[model samples]
Target: MALEGAAAPGVAARRGLGMFVVMIGVLISAVDGTIVVLALPAIQDDLAMSLSSVTWVVVSYLLVVTVLATQVGRLGDMYGRVRMYQAGFLVFVIGSLLCALAWNAAAIIAFRIVEGVGAALIAANSGAIISELYPPAERGRAYGFNAFGWSVGSVLGVLLGGVIVTYVSWRWIFWINLPIGALALVLAVRVLRDRGERVRRRLDPVGMITLGLGLFGVLWAMTGLAAQPWGGTQLAFLLGGAAMLVAFVLIERRQAEPTLDLSLFRIPAVTPSLLASLLQGLASFAVLFLVIMYLQGPRGLSPIDASLLMLPGYVVGAAVGPFAGRLADRWGPVLPATAGLAVSAVALVVFALMTTTSSLWLPAIGNVVIMIGGSLFYPANSSAVMKASPPGRLGIASGVLRTFASIGMVFSFTTAILVAADSVPRSTAFAIFVGSTTLDGPLAVAFTDGLSTAFFTMMGVMALAAVLSAFRGRAGSPQRRPDGRAGGQVPA
Candidate 1:
């Protein structure tokens, strides 16, 4: 039987347990997203994978997660967030088990796709679920904690992946998920409860197809642009993807329950916050990827060392994120978000300058600054989006936000690869790190130049984001519902 009503107070004593369950799943998903990067060398040598095949290991998972996240979020709204969350855990665990048993690169990539699907389900609804559990006033705090999981997991993935691959085996990476996932599952079953009303609605099959195809096409183009000629088959996919995306927008406009709510973009507050989140994502994601390459390739650092070098930035950011959230609650989100982006822009400039020299402290300091800026903006941006969205559409809004972040990451990755490819031979491209302090050859030097260009480009984008955030602040403050609940009332 379907569980109804909020859990009784006695039952609600386990709400913390529910939160724990959600956090564990979040950590697992976040860790898996980057853990494989650290283990790639081991995996490649053990499985004798070609470069292209190894790339698939990461690409496949990302592709699956990005495509399915929004749909899964809508599903959570239609059914129950808890049910979908648990299902995600189960699917993820199964995929992990499959990944552990894989004998070849093909098998591993296939299992990763499955794992990604599970991740999509959890990632899409985790924020909304957490928001439902907490009151509007405390939502920022809750989100801060949630973001902490993501930050910690990202750092741990680098460190743990290094230790695991070095001492144990790459297989242990997947095997580790079993215990953590099981615990989360048990707690979720015992503790989590949903109070949101479920509605029956027809699935927008046309809209879904169009969005999926369009995004797939764009991502494929971006991915191909890394190694293939710009005018070749890859460009074809990019053009096709763009066209499909246009069609998707048209179809959504006509749909009764569009998979995507185009109208939300019209809201004064929603567009800016969302755009800010995307810009932040674009800068942060690209920088991390390029920095990692720079460390490993030209700097001649091992994976473990590279991971360690990046740790301070994440630690500082994670530690300060909650405080930023608290600050956002008191002041408007605009000030913090704008200030954060400005700091990030400055940090990127410093980073670009540091690449001209080989001082470890320069990059480390720049990383810390960038992270602080990111931490400050993330919670504030999220709060703004949540406050701006209609209560009835919270789940959808959360999903859209996550989707934008994912889309930004996709573009960042593609952009990083394209920049690298333009300067280096396809064979040695991945190994080229773009920084001022290190140059191995002409190709390496060119790669560094490309990296500089990308950072400058990111700085420009973040500056624009800061300006937009100020505009968002000027928009009338979010009007609360008559009952005084910020997010509980349905949209009129």
Candidate 2:
């Protein structure tokens, strides 16, 4: 019950240190998410990349992480989570170094893929690692700190990306990760220890290959559709990817140790928690891109200036996350998680109401509203999933959670560009997104209208997320223990 010991001397201190190290991992991943976006134009100019190719600098990392998260998490379950996590740090550092030294477009994209593998390893296991260290009662608070890492990292990425891209070289962006990662890697080795039981399951090569290739095919098509008009190629990839995914499901059902532990969904709380995360991600991830497009496209703000507008929200959200997580720990996940989604949906409504002539403060206020909602949702949703997961399957649960969230993120990226392009020329819409071009006059008005449409669409998605969150049952109830009992209470 509750991971071996609570009264042991020095264990609590070690756990605290371990959690701190894990937060740093979350920080690095979050920083990378936004940092690269601001530097894309400079990278394009320096490397003489075509418009389409520059976007891959961002897409490649997301794609690789999305594809490999579950498989790597399985590795964590088979080996040691701590061992794989340390390896993630090493590989990420090396990939960043390669990125800093990259000479051409193709090289940087390839290096980003390398970086993504490390990221997948880290992202896939961080939750399970936390679960191994902390018990259910405290996981919400721990995840709150995790969200805090994300908030601070998002803010840092924007500020650092802007400052470095303007005054320094874009290469420094990748270089910046080096010192942070190195320190974290050393700390990870010294501070974190594997406390969970290991499963000696055979690797599912068929499931891995099918899932990876399937996701890649669909993602490649979606990213392509975002940059250019849809065609037969996109349709073909979509259908082929769907078919492969179906085959993956069929294969998983027959396997002894399936890559995805589909049985996890049988728990009452698990399915809703995972679905809520995916839907929340689908609805919310693109808001950053959409708002940036709004500021850069119609309002003609520079990248740095636009990012600054969103900074206060991240600041407020970071501060609020721990408190909301405390509420989750006390009240169960359903309340705060669903309430957060409702709050975020309200913010989307506000965003949808904006226009070219609307006050700039409109979006600033909405950003604060949405980030607060996000702070509430992410930690609770995560806590719910991990809390319900059995000790032995924590890695699988964590991996599936990352996989769902990554899928949402990838789709949200494509949805933002494709939906906004409806009101402008496709190339023009893509240019506005990447900060290479700005719109004015009628084009600006039309593009703003498109942004409103996209906002409304996402708002609906958030509503569905709220509904799913509400259905997660009582999160404060006892979770299943390793001894086939509910928490510490034994059956009569």
Candidate 3:
């Protein structure tokens, strides 16, 4: 059997509990990631940080999580999935406490790294844990529920973040994670008791370090774009990062058991879905902060009211998720997934067109359209990737999916900051985005002008995403074997 600890007498009950814990993990990670976006201004004002430096509050978490995702998944396969997953909850709680106690830029960044480590552990293993608990026949539905966790969690983050940043201290954003994480930890320890499957493999330390540094250098260069022109320092880091990435590629080819198995891309179905997800992430994630900035900045709405406008989208997404998963199961991932991307592109266009007198409904209505697209896309793409994976490497496949998604998110975070930096003073843009301050006069008009450029650029990305999604091949088409030595039909 692919899963090792699922043979107990009350297997069904354990599976149900197993599903619950995994879902909770999804909720916690999702909420934690976005909760801080609305509070960035508060963090910057309180800490006396540069506007450019403050974006790290969001980017750092994504960067660390991106770096560790695959490595942690590999560790899960070597040790125990449930054990590592449970540990994530404990560590996340500790990190959250530290963040709440933080006094300045360095302390907050350091503590957030701790939180990101914990987040990586939870995110890397969530899919594998659920995959281990559920048989192949039921995976699509399970993934749909995972999507449910994501939608609900995002909704909670925006709503709760608004309230805390407005009334309570911004520190409460991290502090709030305490009770929620603790409860999840308690349940995870009690309910998720499976030892899970294992594979005998050595950790690829060289590959991990090289890849980590390589991505870090590139991301750091991108982050610099927010502040000033690319100088010698940026160019050096960029080149060095590229060199390290090249070395990582060479090292992986020579290894018996690589950190990232290059062969996973050999699966036709897997590659396109991975790219589609990357494009989707690139095209979407940071738009949340952009819209929030618009409402909280020039529109002069409070954070709470701004976020309230987004409530409808999340509700609709929560409603759409399960049914879309069912559709992917019945038809195939290609149609629904691609269509979702196309639909979301229209929403991006709508967002690009928001004017000074636009109704509060513009973003809210645009969000609804985008979430409907997300509800269709996320589960379908996830189902496509997991279903095509060999049982043994499911963890890595899931890790790769997460890795690509994180890479896109890192870019999204940087891209938003970079684009916004063009029209507003970097500090002011960052401050206005997080609601540390408001904008008026020519500054508001110029900021909107910058947003127009950014959104138009994003529309181009969405178009690319739609094309990639379209090329994911027919749902029932045959895909290459994971090992690349044979062929198999994609399960309908």
Candidate 4:
């Protein structure tokens, strides 16, 4: 018998199960992301790490993911999304195990790089996987559910990280992933089959190396400048990175099979949606860290307590995601997605209004508002990009999207610290960030003002994102096949 919209009975089941596996991957990734934040203090103390070294634990993962996301996504196109996705799980699991058993700062940082590679593989392919599973009209809802996984995982991460770091060892944070990763691997094997034709393109080694080195150089400079004043070393790296990136662009123009696939920008929906995602990411990701810094630094709350205040937002975001996605399906991506960015911009205004003595409810309310905006934007935006992607280019499209977002993320991390440090000593700001110290009185007020400046800057960024989202035009319609799958060529 057929299921909804003429899908075969087992086809629906397989799609459903495949999505479940994908959600698990997202969940594991989200949990790892937030869980590590709260546990950093413990990890630093145990490993006897300096603030700079401890910070690398987080930077290492993000840098690796940012550098490799596109490369791994290309691998998905060349091989199979399912196969590559499963490989991600195995790699992530092993990385987690190594991290849990890490002997020192370097060891954990190296293992985190391994974890980042796994994360890159998973993230780069997930959108392509969803696009292959569901028709264009249904992709928004699927992405909404994916957002739900992120929300739930973030909640679990905060709760579990707090409890484990306080009562148990910090190692338990990584250990928790073992069983979950194993289960996801088994389920993915049973539920996922490769769909769509794999594109066999030669890997562009020069492109990968140039892009990777360029990103590393720029990112290294940014992060270093946060801890130290502008110096020759930082300038050299920054200029060198720019030069390499220019080289990468020229190289891509020459390559028959480019790593980045510059032609994907030909799709009308692809360019704006990606820039919106990048700007929104730039404006959004740092809010969590900034808020936590405020709470822990000036408000004198513990790591767990500070994070708990944001829990309500995550819960609300999870509930709102699927609904916003459905609206995207009906009304197209521009309306809801743009509206979401506007809402987030307003939330940033509220955050900027806060002071050291402001009511705790202020940040709490702002968190809820911002999260609602995120819930609305993320799924719709993702659906737009995937829907516009040509079949053979889906993996690259997803990778490019991920690469842009990760670049924003890594930079956002550095920006938050540097911007906040403008009003206080860099060491104090760094200490508060890692939950190693707190401030009071005059220092607290100055720090709060600094955060407000950052918030206002982000608000401007979010406004730009909203404008981009508003002008993305419309994602083209694809004809549906008899089996309820999208047919016809996607418009460029």
**Residue 223, candidate 3: how far off, in angstroms?**
2.2
Write down the RMSD of candidate 4 (Cα, Å). Answer: 2.9
CA lDDT of each prediction against the hidden true structure: 0.74, 0.85, 0.81, 0.87
Whole-model lDDT, model 3: 0.81
lDDT of 3 by residue, 421-456 (tens): 789887777677767788877898889878878888
Query: Which predicted model would earn the best lDDT?
Result: 4
RMSD of each: 4.1, 3.4, 4.2, 2.9
State the TM-score for model 1: 0.90
Query: What tens-digit string does per-residue lDDT give for candidate 4 at 250-325?
Result: 9999999787777878878888999999899899988988998899999999877888898898889889988988
Model 1, global lDDT: 0.74
Model 2 Cα lDDT, one tens digit per residue, 40-76:
8788889988776787787778777777777788888
Residue by residue across 315-366, what tens digits does model 1's lDDT show?
8877877887766665657777788899999998977764534687777788
lDDT of 3 at 334: 77
**After best superposition, candidate 4 residue 234: deviation in angstroms?**
2.2
Candidate 2 Cα outliers beyond 4 Å, as residue runs: 1-9, 475-492
Question: Which pairs of residues collide in candidate 1?
Answer: 355-436, 356-436, 434-448
Ranking 2 against 3 by lDDT, winner: 2
TM-score versus the correct structure, for each prediction = 0.90, 0.94, 0.92, 0.95
Candidate 4: lDDT over CA atoms? Answer: 0.87
Best by TM-score: 4
Give the worst 10-residue stretch by lDDT in candidate 3: 478-487
